[model samples]
Target: MDTPSAAPHRMAPSGGCPHADNARLLARGAVVPVVLPGEIEGMAVVGHEALKEFLAHPDVAKNARHFTALREGRISEGWPLLTFATVQGMTTADGEDHRRLRSLVSRAFTARRVEELRPRIEELTVSLLDDLARAAASDGGVADLRHHFALPLPLGVICELLGVEDRHRDRLHRLSGHVVATDIGPQQVIAANRELVAVLGEIAQARAEHPGDDLTSALIAARDEEGDRLSQQELIGTLVLMIIAGHETTLNLITNAVRALCDHRDQLELVRSGHATWGDVVEETLRWDAPVSYFPFRYPVRDLTLGGTVVPKGTPVLAGYSAAGRDRAVHGSDADRFDVTRPRRGGAVRSLSLGHGAHYCLGAPLARLEAGIALEGLFTRFPDLELALPEGEPPRHASFVGNSVLTLPVRL
Candidate 1:
């Protein structure tokens, strides 16, 4: 890709930057230095136009060959969760490999298949809301909505779709939390990953023994005309991917939506008063405070130029989705504001929340359906739902990849 002629700009040092404390500087419109763990140095693609171009580039591959420390012969050990994700899976593959894996999974995860889950999703949403209301009543009409609602809704939906037994939910949840935690030490992360993989392996083994109507079974039996199928490791990795990507991102989406609505009462009232649909609320929230803060570790197969900086081959590059969402150039001056009735650029809400191109999220349809149902159900059930905590005090999860409120204390 040709480099832009504009001089690269530096990102201001903000204590709140998610990845690193003194991370190298980069700007929304320019390519500049970025410091990542594992001694990986690279440039960040920030603004909407640059990010879109980076994601769609054919030569800027997603293969693990570019960023893995082991692949680069730099070191044997690196970030545990990142290493696990890059080792093998659809997220790290490119070209035919990605096509094959994505194709097989698509058979069971198609838009039609996701739409079929709406009734069940609504049922689950209502049940969780009922529990939240009861809990709030017992606790002086206050409850942590993140714990009771935002978190459980997606967990229930993904567990049902993946055929995970109820007995394993708590353990899986704990392990997944540790895996994504930014504050945890290396040993804890490694241990959590092992346990999570073991749980997924057991689930996969059970599915292989006796197939069912769930996605796991369908994935096991999925085959193409050439008889291509996911291998055993691929099966395990895909399940991990589905579980992590499927629920976690959606969980953050719901949490962020509720938080945004609470912060902007006028916008919440707009949705409540029927001026804006739940779909509008969800889309606006997605653009305003994207669920995934940063898409970590995109690397170039060869040295390449992005924006105005040269990104050497093998250096890790990150797509700052959170920063891009609020880029004033693309979304206008009020991009930082949360406006449900915010006009679309061209009758289309452009967002990278669900990703783009070949690696665009497979579970996006289900997430949208769940979030729409979830928001409608929560607000409709408790028309006067309000944040229990004062404004600007909600605690955030400290994770490099996830941007979510840790707890949403609310009064019904």
Candidate 2:
């Protein structure tokens, strides 16, 4: 009978290592107490089976309205994670609302639509790799691969997909960064949320005034059978969700995959020798180091016991995707080992990185497509690429939710 102490673990809002933190938490039990941003007490579902149960359980809901603390005036409106929880988009919605919201964007991400973007994705990959070569040539044979390559490929793709203008891209990226970063000050978090809403609102308004062949335009013009359409707040919220989630996750995926291959040269050899495919590399990296480490605030509809812990009704439960990825119970004793040749049973990759059930990531197919193209293009162009970090491992991104390095310097 694993039982955690009554006192909650003080999860750092930023700076501390996630791998170590998650390991210590998981060692205690599947479900453990945690202190979130704004001093809000919650439970972290960290074990393999426990997390799956949490995700699939109908009683564990995504709507923030169900959160007892927030509803009862205990939580602050400016809490760092409030934007994630209180958004009116599909991610925080449940049942009919989620289905309706998801359906609008689902069309743009259909198999045919994503396939149509392959040529463009390949073109962007080639262009970015060329730029990386030029940068390395001029900068003593080294360049920050993350900035020059990984960041821009998906960023450019997503910006084009949503019809974001050139002028808005930089500010949009910066504001989105602050929203996901747990390390920022409370005031900064509030300001970021406010500014993000303003910027997205502006874009949504522009799309309404003048339509284009883009998602924003389509969303603006969409209406269901009963003439139901997204409200102003919902439109902006959904755009915020799409814009941030679109590039950020894929950016980290590409960077993490490269870092993993660099660390495990043997795995690279497997790909080089045709023993493993780029798809294999992408799938393995997602399982080993998911881009999103911890997703916030899933509320329980009623009191329930999970992983031996009694969680009261309306308590916030975080989905511990990173910890669950490395669970030895699911992946066997060598779960930590990075192996590209590992057999994925029946061709389905076992990973909760993209999520599960109704709220599973809608951009998954596109993300996978972008990552596979980027990795193959990069390695083929620069097979001898190596990490150029002189001061040990590169600094990790200071966000509990985002798992990635701040910079990935490499020699071409």
Task: Identify the leading candidate in terms of lDDT.
Answer: 2
Task: List, residue by residue over 302-377, the lDDT tens digit for candidate 2.
Answer: 9988888888898988888888888877876777888877755554438888888888899999999999999999
Query: Could you tell me which residue pairs clash in candidate 1?
Result: 11-26
Instruction: Name the regions of candidate 2 deviating beyond 4 angstroms.
Output: 1-6, 223-227, 345-349
Worst 10 residues of 2 by lDDT: 223-232
**Using Cα atoms with residue i matched to residue i, what is each candidate's TM-score against the true structure?**
0.90, 0.96
| Model 1: per-residue Cα lDDT over 248-308, one tens digit each | 8888899889988977889999887888889888888788778887666677878877775
Best by TM-score: 2
**Pairing residues by index, what is the TM-score of model 2?**
0.96
